[model samples]
Target: MTVKEVKKGNACALLPLIIFVALFIGAGVLTKDFSNMPLNVAVIIASAVALLMNRKEKFEIKVSIFTKGAGHPNIMLMAIIFILAGAFATVAKGMGAVDSTVNLGLSLLPANLLMVGLFAIGCFISISMGTSMGTVVALAPIGIGIASQTDIPVALTMATVIGGAMFGDNLSMISDTTIAAVRTQHTKMKDKFKVNFFIVLPGAILTAIILGVITRGNKAVIGADFHYELIKILPYIAVLAAALAGVHVLIVLIGGTIFAGGVGLADGSYSFGSFLKTIGEGLMSMEDLAIIALLIGGLVEVIRHNGGIDYLLYTVNSKIKSKKGAEFGIAGLVSAAAIATANNTISIVVTGPLAKSIADEYEIDPRKSASLLDTFAGSWQGILPYGGQMLAAAGLAAISPVSIIPYSFYPILMGGCAILAILNGYPKLGTKSKEVKQVATVPVEE
Candidate 1:
């Protein structure tokens, strides 16, 4: 390619990404309804814009780029997981798992201890499963159900779930963000986990304390009669144990559905036909989100084809002059990519290669860099009201997604602490290895 052609091509990459942000964020603001505009529609418009911007390329080449984006391994893996999760969640709920779980949970705790316990559970489940969405899906309804029984606001309960989920999502070794960051930055997972744990540890503790204090006033103890039979609680426990076992999340969810169905039918809680109905309901419940997922996949493909990612990378790298700036760049890159994509794992994957290159140039510690990428992306994912995790939490709680934004202390603090630690050199990047010379060349934001 000629010099001018290459420059133009690289700059063209950002077009779809711009369109996506404008449409998605814009629609949400203009309509004053988070779901007023379908995510798929916004993605479709942006993708078309991306394709149009790359008109200079051969149609076949353009198609190839789009295909590559859609077929990216990370994207495909997430999609499959979404499908299975949908099926499992629907079946479990239909078969009375959600109700049973909720009633059982409520009956087991004092009202004063409800909020903190819910948050703690959210944290534990997400940490074990390495997924915020999975945790939110499994726990948000329970939180909401608890709220309805008491006088607690559902939105507050929803925020509790979101906060706890983010704590684990940011630090969990099995998280997609962690994998993407580690692979891209060439770091050990255990090392990154250590760096991240310290940064977010205080935030998690503080949030839990705050929630505990807030709920402490309501001290009513739940009665045993309100609890479901112990058998009914098997599905959730099984799912949690399986996730902790490092079983693939898809399998864990499927297993939960089977266990729930078997126990439900055997206990006369549900008929076989109802069990199938429950499964179908769960699968169908995720239909809207599934469409949104596919649209995001296709939209990102167009953005990648049009050079949007490269454009951002080039601009960001040109201005980095120090270790602090490099750290900030890494955080900002992953944060921006995640907000645009609404998927932490994909965000890390998209930003990882470039972040890796930056780390190499700055002689920054690979482990620190990896931790920053994962922590920031996961943090951003938590705060983004439109993101799948928050959306799922909001939907399950029957609350507005934005309602959880201000109160999501864990994610917000994680982002702040990660940036602060980088600036202060708290983790001491040189501890692991000699500093590699920096290679970054992106324009610095003024």
Candidate 2:
């Protein structure tokens, strides 16, 4: 199809996405139970609508488009990461790593500092690992354990993990969202990190102070008598080490899983049969996420084929009136994509090319564009009740994800800073920067 033909189909093709959103959100609102409507079901209905919209295409052609979307390299790679993460998580839990790590961290912090410490540790781990989900999974249980022993509210404790996870997610070089943004905008990761850090750091500090006050007089006794086998912690250590070495995230997760299995076997926590079983269990645990990922891939593929993304790019870019307006547009684009995808990395992937195009058209710095992508995506992911980061943390803490949204300091701060920076043009694109000319035109790369 010609570009004009593609453009003509964009709006019509995108109607299914509107339908999906309305059905899913409306259903959830009416039922007051988001889970009442299965995520995959919503995607399936959306996909059907997309199929029906392509009236001129043969069934085979439409199926081919769907296949292309489901098989995108980035989507496949994420599936691998999810599988490995599941395996590592299960093996680590079986080895008592979770308990040990929780106790270890709790014992180290002063009673009065538990709230601050949780936030700090969450941030540290996410920054180290470059994954908000990983950070929340590692720390939320500890927050729950602490809450059980202390007078602190479980929801508040959960919010600490949420806040800290977003703090690191927004600034970490290894984060998938960061990687997607930098790659898409053709900017250096270090440059983006510098901009992101300054914007989120103050909010983190203020959050620490606020949490400290709220949790005052709720000190819990952190016992030190528990025995911990250092070997059990190898999975997390290996994951962190690989991420620090700048390994690809999928490979790092797979390596961690292998390490965790070896440790589990060495500790006699699993026999060969049980080790294999653990892998199966781990894979099974990720079934929900895997399905969600595939459905989203297929659904978005339909949307892309119909021109939804192109329509967005055309409409959003054409309205840019100034540098500040362009920046706000970029932020809104990334935020909208993140809300749709519910995964920051995927959101960046979906929006990054368009953002680069807008940045180039407006003479915005690639680094600034990348920073906006990370900042906005991280902000939305952090506070979104249905987003994976909050869901993972809430699940671990046994709290409502929405309960943490209002108190998530880093996300709220990031959003505010992003808006302020855009308005003030604080990180102005350097005229001498090579990327100012290089990143103006962005096309979806297969």
RMSD to the hidden true structure, all candidates = 7.3, 5.1
lDDT of 1 by residue, 1-446 (tens): 21112232376566666676676667777886556555567667776776666567887776667666665554555455555666665555555665565455555555578887787777766665556776687787677767777887888888888877788777664455665565556555556677778877877888878877777788654444654566665666676566545565556767877887888788786798888877777667656555554555566566645565456555666677787898898888888878866777767765676677677767678878888888888788888887888888877777788888877877887788787788788765446733223223321110
Worst 10 residues of 1 by lDDT: 437-446
Q: How good is model 1 by TM-score?
A: 0.71
Best candidate, lDDT: 2
Q: Worst lDDT window (10 residues) for model 2? A: 437-446
Compose the digit string of candidate 2's lDDT tens values, residues 195-311: 667666667777888888877776567664656666676677777666656565556666777787788788788888988898889878767666666666777777877778678
After superposing all C-alphas onto the true structure, candidate 1 shows an RMSD in angstroms of 7.3
Cα TM-score per model: 0.71, 0.78
